[model samples]
Target: MAQAARLDIMSIAALVAFALTLGARTTFCEGISCGPGWEAFSSSCYKKMVDPNGWLGARFHCVLEGGDLVSFNSSAEEDFVKGKMGARSFWIGLSNLECNHKLCPQVSGKELKWSDNTLLNHSNWATVKVASTNLESCAYVLPNAHKDYHPGKWRKVSCESSLAYMCKRSPDGCQEGQPCNKTAGLALTPVQTSACDPGDFLRGHFCYRFENTKKTWQGAEDDCVLWGGHLASVHSREDGDWLIAHMEDNFHVGLKKNIKMFEWRDKTAMDPALWYPGYPSSDDCGRVSRTGQVYNHQCNSLIVFTCQKGVDVTHRHHQAHLVCAHLRSFSHPCSPAHSTSAAPRLE
Candidate 1:
């Protein structure tokens, strides 16, 4: 009878423990809080920046603060946004276009996708079909821009159009410094060396430098050109990842709003893979954070920027020397050319 009583007590204890575990998870939202000036709702936090920027610039500011443009998942969330936005139009996290390349690629389908890859289960478009033209694929919500700004109505616009943007973040993820760390054990393969001037770092086929002086977007671009390169054109996720790994603070990227879609300064199609997702819209220029996310912003804003230049002939000769060094090490198959000259080491 004593054993039976103890067993019954153990079962009750276990049941109570399970209840406590469930309760803690339910209260996690309570424990997590947004940063100052950010509003909290459910499990996420939001802040509306009144500064005018292209869609990309707005998204960059949010990412710099550890979030992205707000993405809506339900009618309630949409309604909540409507209430928060009040009578002003603002950029959201929806865009049908991707522009990391020199040119914006045509999407296969007309359906709009969220930059954050949120599920497209619910929508509150003002029109039955979203107008996704080749040049205008970035989206925004017009809750009360005017009497005609239908509540909950969505509009697709050219990414270059500047407007105030809204940012959203989950309170659980808000604690802060650099969120992405240099990946251990995954050594990047050295592709080429450069005779880049002091302060420049070589990565793959190009050399990059973060200028100390701040300038307006156009002025920055001009400076890059004068230094024998253009503003950096990030082509892939690898590029973005590598960039953020080495860069600090928010800086201008190379994307600019064209007639309809965003384009790289060099006129190449953008690699969608480089974006943080749901980005590069309704802005004439781009900005990046230490997190490696790309965002739209205004062209006239004064900010620090990055630059890129191709390896010159001196670097090419260094690459040849490296190739010769590899051949010399394999003495069994060493050729006369390898034996005649000592391999020059490139720093």
Candidate 2:
């Protein structure tokens, strides 16, 4: 409550106008309340990001805000989205794509699921099947831009296509008549992660920890997320070498082999020479041996693993006034800026 009650001293009117056009005027809309920059419906919070970016970039933006690209569980959610989202094509979380060698290629049998890995139970496909290629495997919601185009329906397209997007998350705990700590620009009340948790080693922009307990690839990844990190990703040989030297045992990594190539779990560029020769021929998951050699393995196999998260994300604050239409710089682990490896010192 102490953190949520902190008021950063912005004019109430200004805060409302800047963040998604919601102010005190709409706080009680539909008998629900959300943070200053979000709208509430059903049991979740929604924000429409008008700035156009690629699907990956847009998802990262939502991640920085502690959410993910919007996922619809039912038609009611879909209809709710249709009413709030503007009449412009926007990226939703549904995709049958995976990052492979810097390209978003279609997986042979992957279904269009939400980014959080939820199976699609309901859909509003544009009533046509668009053949997916190496580049056209992502789905986007179409707006009423054309009389012939069906608004609120979805279509498959290239992940690289720049489009606006929507983000969804549980609402910040603020009821009507409560003081919302959020500010305009959806700063979302930046929280301080000044240091990694105890026993985690701070290195460069991330903290790394080797887990001794064996767990399946998906299990390891989920544990990392629960610990505020992910299975460690290697973007350079130096980082790979560090992992080889410091990590204690074989483990599942964030990289996964798909379509004959390996892609980093965070979707950063992968080092081409990190794999052991004759390895990674046709496995679904990735593991790094003690020698730093990358290998592909069955995703359901159990193994120890490593986790990594940004070292520190400085708290950000902006006041006075901010224009509502554009996105600010990303200052967290989800951004590519935090992906590089720096000199490591275990604490």
Candidate 3:
């Protein structure tokens, strides 16, 4: 009997714990409690009193309880309060004390700006005119059926008339300047680098290279010029280092084949001094093989070729048909020499 009783007690305790856990996830709306004519918005409560008080007096009332007159931005927000509080007229936080004489003069004094700072402009006014006499020279916000202002409009009204007024209390349920930190049990981590890098110029992170033997050095240079780039030249040691590191073992630089005679495309009468050591003499012109191996070939042999700039680290197999420099000052205009009439082979 004692064992059965112990099991029953354990079951009861488990049920109570489960109920508490479920209750923790539920949100309750207690509605506004500020007198009979007030409405609630989320956690804060608002009331529209029928006793017409001047704007200054209304503001003072709100301030006394650590609150302020309501300032609304969107139709949804207005409708939300109206739906909750039911149709009633109320005084809002707007007044026409500044620039009152001008046609459609804006009420200038905004004690605080909303996050979007839209209320600072005060342009969304209702079109109806407030009679000069009723012109408490102020504006009141209305709600529900009595909330009959033109949609997307505002109206100026009098402060002395006994109309319901709105009151908004801070949702924190605490006084200002008190610490209201909620994440007492949690921690946050910092990011080490920005999500993106700055100064990245390459498109699709790629560079191109081109090859030609049908033209003389001058003609070849012209071909490059027409294509918006010059003969690919290394601008800095960093560039050279990148090329050396990324290039395949048998890659060619700038040599051309002429019936077994080899020469640099730049046409400088030097002893092929620029050729990286054991290169150029292996063949006269450059050609990238099917396996991406670069070697010197006879110039007369019309092997379709081009020089490429940088290699894309992400995709090593992809090759560029033409290489171009990213110039700093002068912009170069070059178009592809080959026509799109013929489909390109992947190899």
Instruction: Write the residue-wise lDDT of candidate 2 on 81-186 in tens digits.
Output: 8777766567788766442211222343345667755567877887655443322246777654223335567866544345677878767443232223332124
The RMSD of every model to the true structure, in order and in angstroms, is 21.2, 19.0, 31.6
Worst 10 residues of 3 by lDDT: 188-197
Q: Count the backbone clashes (under 3 Å) in each candidate.
A: 22, 1, 27
Could you estimate the TM-score for every candidate? 0.39, 0.38, 0.29
Worst 10 residues of 1 by lDDT: 178-187
Candidates 1 and 2 compared: the better one by lDDT is 2
Q: Which stretches of candidate 2 lie over 4 Å from their true place?
A: 1-33, 98-109, 128-136, 172-347
In lDDT terms, how accurate is model 3? 0.35
* C-alpha-based local distance difference test score of model 2: 0.56
Which runs of model 1 end up more than 4 angstroms from their true locations? 1-32, 99-110, 145-149, 174-347
**Winner by lDDT:** 2
Q: Candidate 2 vs candidate 3: which has greater lDDT? A: 2
Tens-place lDDT per residue, model 1, 1-347, is: 11211221222222222222333333222234675778887767888777555454455445445566788888787778678777555677776544211112233234567655677788777668765433334577755322332444776653323456677777775323212101111111212222344335445445676675788889999999999998998776556654554443577878887787778887896666666667766667888755566788888888888898764534334433553344334331222111222112111
Clashing pairs in 2: 205-311
